[model samples]
Target: MAKFSVSLKARLFLHDHGKLLLLKQTKPNGGNYSLIGGTIERKEFAIQTLIRESQEEAGIELSEDDLELVHVLHKRSAKEHRIVLYFRAYHYDGTPESKELEKFENVEWWSLKELPKNLTGTVRHVLKAYNAGLIYSHLRK
Candidate 1:
């Protein structure tokens, strides 16, 4: 049987200029850029997890009013299952920085039209979904 787990993720959209913020992880898994996100703690609501991760990973504080649920994607890896809750933030304070430098190298903003070509498959899928205006939750093989 496959091990199942719940992973919470949120993508930060900066303003209405069609730009997205991303972080480049360092060490262990360096040079890979991904959204600002992490796993959800047990018993934590998905929205709460989104807020927590934004603060932890990017130092951005998000409230319910500041975010809109985009989608929930079911992703499965070789060893674990993930329920990724994606969100779009229209309002926020503070700049994004690599608070966890030991694991995160840098944070930068990429225009939607100029996303890095080397994003992981999962990231690519999310971006495509967002661009296509299909934010509803879905299962991924």
Candidate 2:
């Protein structure tokens, strides 16, 4: 048996009506739409990470009471193994904008039924699972 390193991420599914909040990254960063979130820090919990990430990446403020854990994904890519926690929040403070200009270019709302063609693969998979009332899913690449 061998030991492996796994990264943990916390993502937000901030939505209203039938729309979701998504970020468009600069070309150097991937040039695709993705959720607002980041890696969980060494001393932070998933919820705490989401709270901090929401503020830093999108200028949206989230409280512990505003978030609900909607899905968990175990993803194994060629580069790394990761466990991502997706939180759904219909309530938050401040209008969402791209605060990290180096990584993201635009902050936009998209209809769930008409998602952009450039949406990230991971986001698409997670959203499908979440919408299907799944709490956990696995993906390998």
Candidate 3:
């Protein structure tokens, strides 16, 4: 029997002025714009994972005071059989830049008015939920 494990993931919405920072994934399963996020390590808190992933992937280091807890989502993928804890950050310091990650191809800033059409599924869903005033943990399945 395949056991399902709930995976906690953190995402940062690193917004500056009115634009939001997004990254372009480049890997075996690469795709368009998405937030700066990654999986939480073993025994690591969501907040810690958020900060760590932000710096590792986006090259931006942020403190607890620099981020606001926008949402926590329960995203489950049937294929992977894992739960993802989604988070968003509205405040932070320093500029976001692309690091030397082969998984990421490019980085760009997009405003709320202008979002790429080729965005990933998760990114699309999160944006919709945020706009619908839904910024908290919710079960996907």
Candidate 4:
């Protein structure tokens, strides 16, 4: 078997007034909460993916300069391996409206201290890294 190359993902770390933005998943990858983002498209930079995904999933606009690369996580599971680029965003345009209704229930804000328990493993690891001020992490399943 050939070893596959690492895939790229873009994730948004959006927080405001002591709360973090999250999406309640629906199926296939449901029952777990996660930040708004997606797989990076071909020929697009991770930053571009961040901007695009934020708009697509959350109905908000983000700029390249408005996002800072805070963490780069190398995560591996039995079936998939990828590099998740986490961008810390301090500003966004308007509130996140409900999009991808079939994939996710709704986008909501949760206090850091009162976050939903069923967060995706990826999200949990990412958040933990953020809280710990880590710039990089390697998680394995």
Candidate 5:
């Protein structure tokens, strides 16, 4: 068997009032809207990564008790394999904003029924599957 590396990431779907929170990436980073989260560090768990990333990227504080695992994405590309855990949270502390100035330019909210066309492909896929009540999804490229 061939050995390959798989990256683990945790993302948040912070939804409220029929709207979801998104971070707008800088032009250098593709300028697309993305979920608020980050890669899971070597020593951290998925929930811990989400909590830390939410606070760092969006200034929102999350508790493990408030987060629910909604979807899991297994993505494979020619050069990389990644498994992303998507968590949905209704309750959090602080207002959402772009705290990572270099990576994100703005923070925006869009209705689930009317998502922005500029959303990243992965985000679009995950949202669609999530809304359809699917807990697991796979994407290959």
Candidate 6:
């Protein structure tokens, strides 16, 4: 029998004043901007997942105490199911940079009111949901 599982991932929503931080990607999942975070490892708590992923992807240190739950998206499609938790942190340590040089060439902060055009649909939805204060939502696509 084939095993089935739902992957849990944590994504960050880091904002500096009115500017939002974004990691520049290439094609397919790149050439667009998305939140900096990754999958929750085995035996790791959700907050811990954010902390570790932030350091890896954005090269910044995040604290569980400093993280606030902004949104949670549970999504399902034909091939995959995932539970993504969005955490917002107003403050963190170190300047943000792309650790994956090949995958991401640059990281920039864009105005929250005027985000870049090449953004993932999911990310765009998340941003709107954040702005509208829609805490929990589900996406099927």
Error of 6 at 92 (Å): 0.8
What are the runs in model 2 whose C-alpha is more than 4 Å off?
Answer: none
User: For residues 1-141, what per-residue lDDT tens digits would candidate 5 score against the true structure?
Assistant: 667789999999998999999999999999999999889999999999999998899998999998999999999987789999999999999988899999999999899989999999999999889989999999996
RMSD of each: 2.6, 1.2, 2.6, 1.6, 0.9, 2.0
lDDT of 6 by residue, 16-119 (tens): 98788889985544588887888889999889988997788778898888898889998888767899999888899998998877667667898987888888
Per-candidate TM equals: 0.83, 0.95, 0.83, 0.92, 0.96, 0.91
lDDT of each: 0.74, 0.93, 0.73, 0.87, 0.93, 0.85
lDDT comparing candidate 1 with the true structure: 0.74
Q: Which is the better candidate, 3 or 6, if ranked by TM-score?
A: 6
Candidate 1 clashing pairs, residues 3+ apart or interchain: none
TM-score, structure 4 vs. true: 0.92
In order of listing, the candidates' clash counts read 0, 0, 1, 0, 0, 3
Q: What is the C-alpha lDDT profile of model 1 across 1-141, one tens digit per residue?
A: 656755555455544467778888775885778887776677777678778878888888788888777766777666666777777887787888878787788888888888887666678887788778876545556
**Given candidate 5, what's the lDDT at residue 48?**
97
Better of 3 and 6 by lDDT: 6
Compare candidates 1 and 4 on TM-score and give the better one.
Answer: 4
Model 3: what TM-score? 0.83
The best candidate in terms of TM-score: 5
Tens digit of per-residue lDDT, candidate 3, span 1-141: 766666667777777778878898777546677788778788788778888888787787788777666666676655343445555566666677778467777778888788889888777777778778886545454
Using lDDT as the yardstick, the better of models 3 and 5 is 5
Write candidate 2's Cα lDDT for 1-141 as tens digits. 556779999999999888999999999999999999999999999999999999999999999999999999999976678999999999999988999999999899999999999999999999898889999999997
